[model samples]
Target: MVLYGLKNCDTCRKALKLLPEAQFQDVRADGVPGDVLKSAYEVFGAQLLNTRSTTWRGLSDAERALDPLDLLAAHPTVMKRPLVDHDGQLYLGWNSDVQAALLG
Candidate 1:
């Protein structure tokens, strides 16, 4: 399993604590792999973009208007938190549903 998220994200930290076996890939330090990002985007659609994030808020209207993939590539942190990859299936967020799916 691979966890793509920021080290400073509390939700990510909580997920890492519970999923100790998952390899943590800090998205800020090393951006999500292109293939993985694309796959996640395909599955999650606009949900993959964290429009509420500080990065998103800081973006100019023009920048925000860019394709979500472009925004994510330029600002990795703008992607939603704790995007977990398990056996090639993508799971977004560390919510109860995800916890049950991953940890059960």
Candidate 2:
């Protein structure tokens, strides 16, 4: 499995602690693959974007008007933390429900 997130993000750190065996990919450094980003958008839709993030807040209205994929490609931190890909299934976020689904 692979976890896509910013290494410094607190939520990503917590998720990493839970899934030590999973490979960690820092989206800012490694960049999210186009295919994976496409798949994530398909599965999670707009939920895949973290609108509440400062990164999102900093985006100009013109940038916000861009397509979700374009926005993510331009600003990886705007993605919701801990997008887990396990056995080809995509899971977004790291809440109790996600923990139960992935860790249980």
Candidate 3:
């Protein structure tokens, strides 16, 4: 399992603690690969974008209007935390449902 998120993010840190075997990928430093982002977008659609994030708040209206892929490519932090790739399946966030699906 590979988890994609910012190393400093509390949520990511918690997720790492929960799943010690999961490999952590710092999206800020390594960036999300094109294929991974494409697949994530396909699976999650607009849910992939964290519109409530400070990064999203900082973006201009024009930037907000841009394509989701382009927005994500330019600002990885705008993504919701703890995107997990487990057994070729993509899961977003560490919510109860995700926990049940991944941990249970």
Candidate 4:
């Protein structure tokens, strides 16, 4: 399983702290592999992109319209933080609901 995000990302840090045993791959540092990137897009589709993040908001309108797959493939930062992959399933972000689901 892989958790994708920047090591310093607050949500990522919190999620990691919550699941200390879980393996993580900081996308900013490790960089997602082609197969992983493709899997993320296939699993989560546009939801993988964090359109609400400051990173996404900072992008120009033109940059925003580029296909999410392309953006994710080209610049990993465009993808949402705290992506979790477990048992071949992918999830985006770490929210209360996600934590509850994981805990359940």
Candidate 5:
């Protein structure tokens, strides 16, 4: 399993605590792979972008108008946290549903 998120994020830390065997990737440092990003976007649609993030808030209206993938590529922090890839399945965020799926 590979989890992509910010190293400093609290939610990411929590997920990491439970999934010690999972490989963690700090999105701020190493960007998500193109294929993973594309697949995530397809599965999650616009939900892949964290509109409530500080990074999203900091962007200008013009910048916000860019494609969701472009925005994510330009600002990794704006993407949702703890994007987990287990086998070939993609799970976004550390919500209960995701926990159930991964913790199984």
Candidate 6:
């Protein structure tokens, strides 16, 4: 199991706190690898990006025009928080329903 997200993000923090036993790869300190981001994009499509994040809203019009792959490659921070990969399944954000399914 691999969780990809920043350390400071609240939702990410919640996910980590909720599942203390889960393994995580902190993207803020460790930096999200290109291949990992690419796989995330493929798995979640635009859903991978958290539109509600300040990072997403702060992007310039030109930045928003970039494709999914380019967007992730350029600014991984814009990607959704608490993106979890358990085995091969992917979950975007931390929803209770999703949590229930994954934790089981």
Question: Each model's number of backbone clashes?
Answer: 0, 0, 0, 0, 0, 0
- Each model's TM-score? 0.98, 0.97, 0.96, 0.82, 0.98, 0.84
Q: Report how far residue 18 has shifted in candidate 1, in Å.
A: 0.2
Task: Give the per-residue lDDT of model 1 (tens digit) for 16-73.
Answer: 9999999999999999999999999999999999989988899999999998888899
Local accuracy by lDDT, each model: 0.94, 0.94, 0.93, 0.80, 0.94, 0.79
**TM match of model 4 to true structure:** 0.82
On lDDT, who's better, 2 or 4?
Answer: 2
Model 5 per-residue lDDT tens digits across residues 7-80? 99999999999999999999999999989999999999988999899999999999999988888888989999
Worst 10 residues of 1 by lDDT: 64-73
- Tens digit of lDDT per residue, candidate 6, span 30-89? 767777777777877878877887888999999998887787667778877787877767
- Prediction RMSDs, each to the true structure: 0.5, 0.6, 0.8, 1.8, 0.6, 1.7
Model 5 residue 60 CA deviation in Å: 0.6
The residue ranges of model 3 lying beyond 4 angstroms of the native Cα positions read none
- Model 1 gets an lDDT of 0.94
The residue pairs that clash in candidate 2, if any, are none
TM-score of 6: 0.84
Q: Lowest lDDT 10-mer window, candidate 6?
A: 27-36
Model 1 vs truth, CA RMSD: 0.5
Candidate 1 versus the native: TM-score? 0.98
